[model samples]
Target: MARFELKLPKMGESVAEATITNWLKQVGDKIEMDEAVLEIATDKVDSEVPSEVSGILIEQLFNKDDLVQVGQTIAIIETEGGDVVVAKQEATPIAVADVAKTVETAKESVSAPANFSDSDKFFSPLVKNIAKEEGVSVAELESISGSGKDGRITKEDLLNYIKNRGNQPAVAPIAIGTAPVVATQNVAPVAQKAAPVSVNGGDEIVEMDRMRKLISGYMVASVQTSAHVQSFIEVDVTNIVKWRNKVKDAFEKREGEKLTFTPIMMEAVAKALKDFPGMNISVDGDYIIKKKNINLGMAAALPNGNLIVPVIKNADQLNLVGMAKAVNDLGNRAKAGKLKPDDTQGGTYTVTNVGTFGSVFGTPIINQPQVGILALGAIRKVPAVIETPEGDFIGIRQKMFLSHSYDHRVVDGALGGSFVKRVADYLEAFDVNRDF
Candidate 1:
């Protein structure tokens, strides 16, 4: 038999690692080529890892909830054919009836909590490194409170423990491959569980899903990172609406796609970014990096009710037709959970359609690394004064509010206000007779 190592393949340009969410196969299970063996989840996407060759699964290197780096061996498969016989070892320590009790203690040190090699509890490599640096015993690690998903100890949890390590009572260090951690009456409790709340029987509690948790952290981080300030302006988009209504049918018939007002607004936003390139910039520490490319991030809601931003690169380069295509493709893929990692990266600015959910206007939080995000409000037909060559009269017109949120540290009121104003200007100045 020949042995093959199944490694986690590279998922995307920016993704370096993924967390093992589940295992579909156990040891000694028959596997087929290209069949999924495990499911892995990155920050923004979930995907299955498939077997590269037909084999019998022999071992699993990592358990569920463990973070695995790209190209790392996750499992072993034994294929039929070759004369090569690979050594297989059980994850647990084997007992030798002839060995002394001291030898058993050594095996315990090599496998369990004392030496920190407990496979039952998942500790990331980063956390293990930090533990090694701080001289924390496996017993101590078992005690540290984990705030991460599934009670997994995170790097932040380890760092916080280090910061407060002085308050911890001094204990004898348990050396790896040496011996077990001696139990004491003064020992601090590890694996602190949250106090369970008593349900009234009718009360149903729903914990946030993985994506929602990630989104929650991101939203909080963005709020803390940027000095957010918003500017709101109302614009009359009667001409743009009229133009879209006039051309939508013909455009759909000709281009084989429905032409929506989103692309039209996105086109105007892109042009306005070119007009005021300062808005097309990102904030670094004490530095403002002005972006040359006008990549627009469109926030789309997924079927699971999670929000994702799939970007359209070179928004300034694409015409109305191309913008529609890009918007449709990205929007469709995002909703279908088919967007690649690169499709969500390199966004210099973001636009969200709050109108889709019936919100009149919203002060949206900024997408990190980028300075600004624009929220488009619901369009409504309201009475307005129409100034003509003859006289001024009250007439009905379609209008929507533009809510622009920017980093106050880098963008002043004038620039933020003017950039959004330029978008309004483009929308108001749209050609009624222009061809798609």
Candidate 2:
């Protein structure tokens, strides 16, 4: 038998590393081909890593909660029928001068934190690197309270600590992989403390899950980063409603997908984006990034009550049938927790259907970098005055409120208001007799 290497597969272009959440197979366990061996979670999604060849799991290179780079060997599997393994010659030991020079270079640049491999607490690569750069000892790290979930230290927390740690001496670098940190310093906590909550004796205290924690951070960051402003408009969608009611059955039968209002709304949003290209842009510091492709982000609600936005690439090019298929596919996958990491990337604009939960209207926070997000309110039948050449009469009409939340910094009132108005106009003008 020969050994085969199991490596972490590339999840997406932007994704470089993932944290191992669980190990499904242990050492000496017999594994089948294409069976999942471990589960990994990136910043975007959680997924399983399957084995390449059927064999006994001989070794695991990383443990749970360890950050592993892509294309790195994660495990070793013994497989049948391969070339005989050959051992390499032993290498020479490092010279003393070379060792000193290496240490000097590390001191000048970035270095790995001492005893990080032996620490029980997980420090992300970023945090560990920052600690090394700032000469923060492991004991010092333990003393500083973390603001992240489960008391885990985040980059922001560490940076805040460093900034507030005025005129402190940089600790001497400890030998790598040698002694555990023995020095403890009295460092003032820099994170702003949350107001204490009063708990009743019968109240249940539940910690936020990993995804919820991440979402909470993102929402707070977006709010702090962008100047949020909203524009509201009531749309007469009686024609689009009648059109969908008429063709949904035929559309679903022919297309093998249910025709929903989401696709219809997405189509209109895509068109409005094309018409007013300024709204499809994202901000980068002092620069504006005008996206060439119209990728629409559909905000989907998960079964766990959390949210995920899976993107539809080049949405403007798809027809109504194609849009419906894409919408149904992404929505189903999102609910099933089967969406890949790339499906959540590259979004130029976003649309959320508050109508799903009977919300009449909502002021949604801007999905950051992207300047705008449109919230579709619930459609209701309301009485309105109808005017023709003959006379005016009272009529019942189906209408919904379009709430557009934009970054007031980049998108002025005119651009933000007109963009949503264009979307409403497209939906209001939808042809009742249009083909599927």
Tens-digit per-residue lDDT, 1-436, candidate 1: 8888888776665565678999999998999998989988777766678887898999999999887766778998999877544333223211123222323323223332234445346665456644654556677776666765445686667667666767865556557788656444543346578898899989988999888987997897688788999999999999988888778898999898889889999999999999999999987655778898999999998878899998999999999999999999988887776676668878999999999988989999999879999999999999999999999999999999999999998999999999999999998988898877
Q: What is the lDDT of candidate 2?
A: 0.82
Q: Model 1: how far is 257 from its true place, Å?
A: 2.6
Number of backbone collisions per candidate: 1, 0
Identify the candidate with maximal lDDT.
2
| Cα error, candidate 1, residue 243 (Å) | 2.1
- TM-scores of all candidate predictions against the true structure: 0.71, 0.78
Once model 2 is optimally superposed onto the true structure by TM-score, how far is the C-alpha of residue 21 displaced, in angstroms?
1.2
lDDT (Cα atoms) of all candidates against the true structure: 0.80, 0.82
Residue 238 Cα positional deviation in candidate 2, in Å, after optimal superposition = 1.4
